[model samples]
Target: MTPPRRFRAGRFLDAAAVHAAADANPRLRRFMRTVAGHGDAGEVRARRLLEHIIRHVIDDVGDLHLGNAVARLERIAVLRERIAGILDHVLEGGTLPEGVRVEALGESFDQLRTEMRELSRPRDGIVGDAPLRLAEDAAAYADSMLREFEAGGGAAGLHSEPAAAVNDAFRAMPADRQAAVRRAAALEPQALWRAVASETEGGKRAAVADLETRLGGRLTPDELSRLRTAVDDLGVARNRGLQVSQARLAEALARIVDPELRAVVAGGDVWLTQQLALHNPEALATLWRRFRDRGGRADDGPGFRAYLRHDMVTYGRGVLGEYTAAFSLSSIELFLKGPDANVKVAGTDLVGIGHDGWVWLVDDKSHRATSVGGVSALTDNLVANLRRDAADFRDAITRLQRDDPGFTPDPRILDAISRMEDAAAEIERINRRGSAATRPARISRALEERRLRLRVTSAAGEVREITQALRDLGLAVEPTGAPVPLPPTGGR
Candidate 1:
């Protein structure tokens, strides 16, 4: 028989609710009470009571013109039991018998559906209303039972379509084996994908052993290959979603004035998108306005600069919050832009060597001025920034060791690391003594030793001190002409 027609709109019941109602019926409850009263013979008495309820209470009640309702309820109860048995068997890793026909299950559902509709029809008198209400309750209970059965794979038990091959193959196995397969499939598909993607030799071996144990048998070579492919596909799909999100963020950052800043924003776009989507969606409009103002036509220079500084603080903090092991080196005000490369160097923002040979240099910046009380504030800020940069340099070395064992540090990186350490020490000494005379010279020497090129924009006044300090270090600085014009803003 075809499965019960889907209900239009009505109250639905779940398996537990249906079972509870069945057990709570007045006649069933009285029989249970009497059985328990027998003390030592309770189990035997309960079984006897159950049989009497089925034969007497249910069968005898039919003579009162409730035969259809009684019969439908009995069939529904039996079907519920069968569905439960099937689900329990599958969940336990057991398989079904080959070519099993669940047509009777479908017929039972259809009968319950029909009886429920009939019982729901309006009754003329109070006496008629009582039976009608009971029938309505039974119908609702059956609907829930049907829903639970479908969810547990009962609905797919008799499908003949090719797409249902997995279900058919599952059904053909022994009940216990079918349950094992279902349990394995249900074991967090996303987690399984990650394990397959990131597991090391030992981890992969352990994962394989665990899977085999759960499945109750060793997978054939072909089966293992197919499973791995499925997991890889899931991982690829997840990465695709991330890339799409990143692209949207990149589009948003297009109006940023500085090429170096734009690149940095792009690098962190994935993390930034997550932050905006989850916490600060309102911040997007502000960020977009800054982007739009940076288009070559606008002369909102001071406002744009202020926005950049604000973003440096807010976005920098957002990054730090997201990455537990994060440390900031320098704010954007101090970033020495590269003359030729689109990248900027500030000390270190995030440092790691990719699978590719290029070493990563990350810098975080905020608009907040470093100096508040003239030279003293400058000294304190320089010292603090140098110390943080030194720490980041050290972290980069440690990461290199972990990622590529026996990897030697590049001479340029090693020299920069040593200079950063010395700079930190000198700046700290100057800060403590409240001396301004040696501050610029010491900072200049450190910048020179690091050999960083500075990007000179048309807004040279913004970085005048930084440029002079670099010049004192004897490094040649050149402007990268006017900032490039940004494309027209696109609608989100």
Candidate 2:
């Protein structure tokens, strides 16, 4: 038989959490104070139980099935109240009829796990989720209970508002369904409060100082000031959109020079959508699930949004070998074939056909910001290579002119080479100036042209290593002094 047709969660407004909230009022607060500092073995157990309940049970694990979720929360409440009762008796300095019955208490959890296993099992044609609003409803209801409980001086309101929640849950349903639900609820007296579970913290934080650590890899050495100024919430700010400014994104993009790789980072118009689909699909799972289930993006916390940006920036790190082929302006046959035709292995970025049956190969000297210092080592080698290539081309033209009296070099090509030589000289001067620099507040203000200079280096060393492998394979490879243009930038 076909499973129930998937319905939008809005069809059923957020219902009461089938489970009630745990009360941590003044009684529990006093209990915590006594135990948290130093108390007997029983106080220690109570404190441990409260911590476990707070960390695990109330955590909102975000289950897809309502029954499994309800069971988990329902049993957690049972456990909390049981501890509350024990604490109450201990505070009164009286021996209770029943203390913490380890076996009996553990049974509630065991039952929850069993029901979760049973409910979580795959059913025929049942690729459906419970109403997403249910989790919202649970959390809201619990918060309301907490507010009311604290307002009542904590000691009171333990049993307050019990009937209202179950009643409200069924209120959205038809009269007949409401009657049936209330009849089935069979609620107990003095057992009030419940809420739904959610996923773990998704890189959200209370302070800007926290972001520096989590996002340390993505940021430049002196990027905290820009990031602090970027958003007051430290990138957790959410209203109707998960918007990361294009400027901030470009700043986070580091010193990437490749256009395709830059596109992967900046993500152009769609921003994070394309980048997530390309590299980290799982990062967008919850958001997509919400879209599928509710046809809307929930006000999911900043943690959720922050995690998304983190994922995009994390994988957006440029690949040395793959992007080397991506920037080819020639008919390069990539060794590592991918959906994108331009992707190629590292050493052979641009391997295309040359005239007279000669094979043309362009090896990328990809460097990462992590590996290279960006200014000194990069420009030193780059300046040397370009000058040598220009001189060799000039000498070759001179020799050709000697043979053919009317031999004239293409002024456009000669100008291109000369213009590049001049550019290289300017690059050298800038590199020297950058060698001894002071730390600036912002990247834009710091070394205005640092990214441009850093873009000069590409992945090297790999090609030289491949030289021995080729010689071993009897290829007798010889180095060429051909006029190659400036190489691409470093990989991740």
Top-scoring candidate (lDDT) = 1
| Tens digits of per-residue lDDT for model 1, 1-492 | 112333211122222222233343776556655765675644223433343223222222333334444555676677677766665766686664345457754665676576556555423212454543324466565465556544644321221112232234344555545443444566533224223322233444455455555545445555555555543333333332423344555555664555544444443323343334334435544564556756722344334444544555454443432132122212222222112221232233333332322222233221133211222212324456556765766787889899999989776556555655675676466456744677556655544454432222211111222335534433331222332232222211
Each model's C-alpha lDDT?
0.41, 0.37
lDDT of 1: 0.41
Tell me the TM-score of each prediction against the true structure: 0.24, 0.19
Ten contiguous residues with the weakest lDDT in model 1: 455-464
Kindly report which residue stretches of model 2 are placed more than 4 angstroms away from their true locations once superposed. Answer: 1-235, 238-351, 360-467, 474-492
Lowest lDDT block of 10, candidate 2: 191-200
- Tens digits of per-residue lDDT, candidate 2, 209-316, equal 443444545545434343343332212222101234335455545444434334433433233443444345454454445443653334433333444554333323
Cα error, candidate 1, residue 145 (Å): 58
Give me the candidate number with maximum TM-score: 1
Give Cα distance to truth, residue 180, candidate 1, Å: 73
